[model samples]
Target: MISILFLIAVAASIITAIMGLSFLISCIWEKETRAALYAGLQFLLMLGLVFLLFYLEATAFFETATGRAGLILGLVLTGGTFALLTLRIGSNPQALQGTRGLMVGNVKRYDERDIVFARNRTLSPGLEQYQAYYELHPEHEQYDAARRKRGGPLGKPGSIDKPQDRPNVAATLASLSIPLHLSTPEKFNPSQHPEFSQQRVELSPASASARIKGYTLSIGAKLVGITEINPLWIYANRGEIFNENWDDWGREIELTHKYAVVFATEMGFELVGTAPHSSTTIASMANYASGAFIATQLAAFIANLGYSATANHLRHYDAALVPLAVDAGLGETGRLGYLMTKDFGPRVRLGAVTTDLALIPDNPVDIGVEDFCKICKKCAHCCPSNSIPLDDQEAVNGTRRWKLNAETCFDYWGKVGTDCNICMRVCPWSHANTSPHKLIRTLITRNRYSRYLFNSMDDIFYGRKPKPKPAPEWARFDE
Candidate 1:
């Protein structure tokens, strides 16, 4: 019995030491010096514990029943505590009651005209739409005008920061030009064929779903999901930018699609690491471009199959991407107002293709995003503009959720000459998908206690305000 307890103690210490060592190595490879230092100390402590246990077992202490009993009790207590943190025990993470566990209210369909991006575009005094909109929403006129004056219209030449303006403009134009240069001769005419592309192509929902998902991945989409179109996810009007699509701005957007194929493309980890910098903008645009390609190609493919499909990308959006992503089972909405995907978190750009094609729809997923975000407010702490809310989610748009201060966030973007991704960069879920971090994600996704455990671990290893890394060589213009 004494030998058995000694073996257990030594084995547990060894296992812990191995885990610590793995984390230490992972942090070092990821260039997280603070995390690596913490991991190294943990490894040494476990190693010391192993040696102490072995020494005690070999000494006169093992001969005493009281000493043996005390050691056994300590091991049991410690092991049990860790087990609770690491294992589900009796918890079901998917049985999530999404908001503080008592979820409430139906989300109403949002008006595209009301979004900050639309408001910013309409702020020009020369635009007739600007005068008409401000007349109705006079309360927002002061702040919106201030945002334009203070921040100077979000990025590059107009902002307070200007050194990287050339590189930022270069990166942005590369993405903006995709739609103009990368299209086929064929196009959708909303006034003409509003439903089926030409003729209906009958296909079973399951097989169509499988084929579509496979093709989306093949076309560079990192994540793809299908959901029956939810009216609430669709926009009420055309308000993204001044374009010829509508007779005038804010025209009612009438999308008659029954299903939406939502997809996301991953942003480069190293590039995103340089948040609030030109590099992150480069990363953001790169993925947005990729998403545009994926969405357009999927739309074309479906159209070829004799189904009506309208691609929604950054340049031509007609819906709320995050909610559509959520309904598609891709992820849940986090407090930072981004879709928290299971594998990639919010470190992705979204695109969608709404169509009349029959496909199996994915049920919404609950990967403990709400539960975890409740504990890990790292994004809120790291946000330069204080845009993300640190408190519990409140009712917004008729649903209980966190609403980011769009005005302040966009204004900060103009100040920095980039859309600051400090929130996404510092999130624990934003860690590289390496073995140790993957394991951590799985553990947290399993239960609430595990979420709390990993959340603290993230803060301890990676500090509350994690430092940003420098951009990759290719993205650096100064050099």
Candidate 2:
């Protein structure tokens, strides 16, 4: 019995030490210095404990009556505890179910003017568009005025706006704006060239979809999905400034596209891990530019094929991206109110090309994200603005889900001079998709018990409120 017990202890220690070493190595390879340091310390502590256990066993401590009794009691207690945990958190038999009904059934269409981005862009104090908007929706006047007083994102002297970082951030924004210049009817309308419009190429739905997906991937899209355009996803009116000379400033936007090709561009983890910093803003703008470049090229490609296509990217979006992305099977809408992909979680920027091309639509997937999100409140706990909800899903806009406080979130962005990404930084799913993390993710996707276990383990390993990592060395500049 003593020999058996000694072997069991040795085996358990070896397994734990191996896991610790693996995690330490992974952290080092990922350049997570803080995490690596912690992992190293943990590994050393585990080794020390294992050595102490071996010493106790080798010294014949368990041969004495009291020592033998104590050893038996310890083994029994440990085994019983593990058994209880296993029974209490056993894997569920059912696969991931559709939670779409929670947010889609009886949903009310959202207005573009009500969106924070639209409001911020249109609410300059002495502008005609501003006055018109205020006259139409008087309730928003006070809040809009207050935000204006605080100054706006990036351009203002705020918490994260270092003088040295401003140029890089501005350059990224400038690059993003260039694509918006091309997002006009003059650019989208193939009819402007009668010869090009006259030559039509016919292809099957499957072939066209494959071509579009392949082209998008070739042009740097991390993920792509096609879906039939749902009218409900389109905005009721044009609230953004699309064209300066266009007569229809706030007129209704009529998107007659039959298909929508949505795609995502990954935001670098190193930059995004910096959270509410200048580096994060730079990454955000860079990804937005990538999305814009991909969407515009794809739209032009379809137009050249004699099919009408319009790129919906940064500074020009006719539809809500999250819903379209969800419908297109790119990802599910996470509790953080961002599209969570299997590879990158919410660490992605979305772009779409709405076109008249016939294509096969991808079905929405059930990858246990909904269930995992239900148990994981790490994002909410780590939010600097405390804008994320801590409770269960609630009904908002006739749909049941975790509704974010967009007002507070945007306000925090203005104060910080960057989009505060604490939620994104700390999401367990946002971890690098290396072997260890991937294995855990697979287990998480397989069962509800795994979700709880992983969530708890993640909290223990990487704190519930993990601090933002420092910006990369290359990102630093002389102030």
Candidate 3:
């Protein structure tokens, strides 16, 4: 009996050690030095405990029934330790409750051209849009004037030392050469088609819709969810849509589509590490293209199934995306006010397809992210333009949340010629998912105590404000 028990104990210890070692190796593969160290320490600790048990046995500490009972107690405790560690590694609370919607009110309808207008205004000797904008917000003129003098990302004396603009512009132009207007149903004039008035499409049942979404998302998209229509997610119209006196413009523009599908394409992290560079621009445009393709294809597929659907992609949009994404169970909004999904943080580009199809609505997930972001202002601290807010989430219009300075943020992007993702690059949530990070995410979700620990540790491991890395070779055209 003693021999058999000893053999079992040894086997269990060996298996535990192997798992720990495997996790350590996996961490190294992800370039996570801290995770590897943590994993190695866990393995060593287990080994020491097992060896100590063996020493006690040999020294006659468990020769009697009482000693044997004590031996059993130690083994059970050791097994519990392993279970606890396993739980920490496997459970991600953020993934638990699915999607949620943010019902924002009182916010003014920002023009689609607002960002472009803001950027242009910040440039030296600004354009007509700049003067018009300043007439509304006169206090911003001084700051705008100062920022405009800095050369843009693609401008002369920009971030790139050589200052080369229009990388593969020929290729980009060729791609855009294909008539994009024809892609829009409204532009194509659906009324012109004889069958358009005669044919009607039916929505699939909720169960079938779920299956379809699951199957289609598995095709390539990173994450997918279905959400009910929310009025706040739509924009009160602006720009040409507003100027044309369209009834839907500048109103709560909720669609008849009962189901909204939100999915994300992973941003190549290695490429994003090189912010304010040509490579970063390339990656951003590439993701936009990829998202557009995915959304277009999905919309077409839904239409073929006899249901009306529309794909909202890059460049053109009629509704707000982040709230829709959150409602669809994608992720919660983080400190940077970007949708921070469970798997990718802000390292994703989003696309959506709305349809009349029936589907299950995901529950709102609370992984303590709001609380964490409240305390962790790493992004705000590192923001070069100081556009991100450092204070608590406040009521903007009516809904309570952090409202980013759109003008300042857009101004920075315009000057850089690239969407400055300095905040995304430095976000603690953007860290590569490794065992230690997984453990920390789990603990923080469960106990407030762990939140404090992780907030500090994250800064120590990766600096409170990390510097941007060099652009990747594959993305660099002017090497």
TM-score of each: 0.89, 0.84, 0.73
What TM-score should be assigned to candidate 1?
Answer: 0.89
The residue-by-residue lDDT of candidate 3 on 122-205, one tens digit each, is 223444544665676577667656655664343334444244445533333333333243245542112323445546555447
CA lDDT of every candidate: 0.78, 0.78, 0.64
Clashing pairs in 2: none
Point out the higher-scoring one by TM-score: 1 or 2. 1
Better of 2 and 3 by lDDT: 2
lDDT of 2 by residue, 146-216 (tens): 89789777647775656776665766577668667666765544342465656888889989999999999
Q: Residue 434, candidate 2: how far off, in angstroms?
A: 2.3
On TM-score, the stronger of 2 and 3 is 2
Query: Which pairs clash in the backbone of model 1?
Result: none
TM-score of 2: 0.84
Candidate 1: RMSD to truth: 3.5
Residue 1 C-alpha lDDT in model 3: 72
| Residue range 154-221, candidate 1, lDDT tens digits | 35455333565576658766886775443322432121244553665667898889999999999999
Please list the residue runs of candidate 1 whose C-alpha ends up more than 4 Å from where it truly belongs after superposition: 60-63, 89-103, 149-161, 179-201, 246-248, 477-479
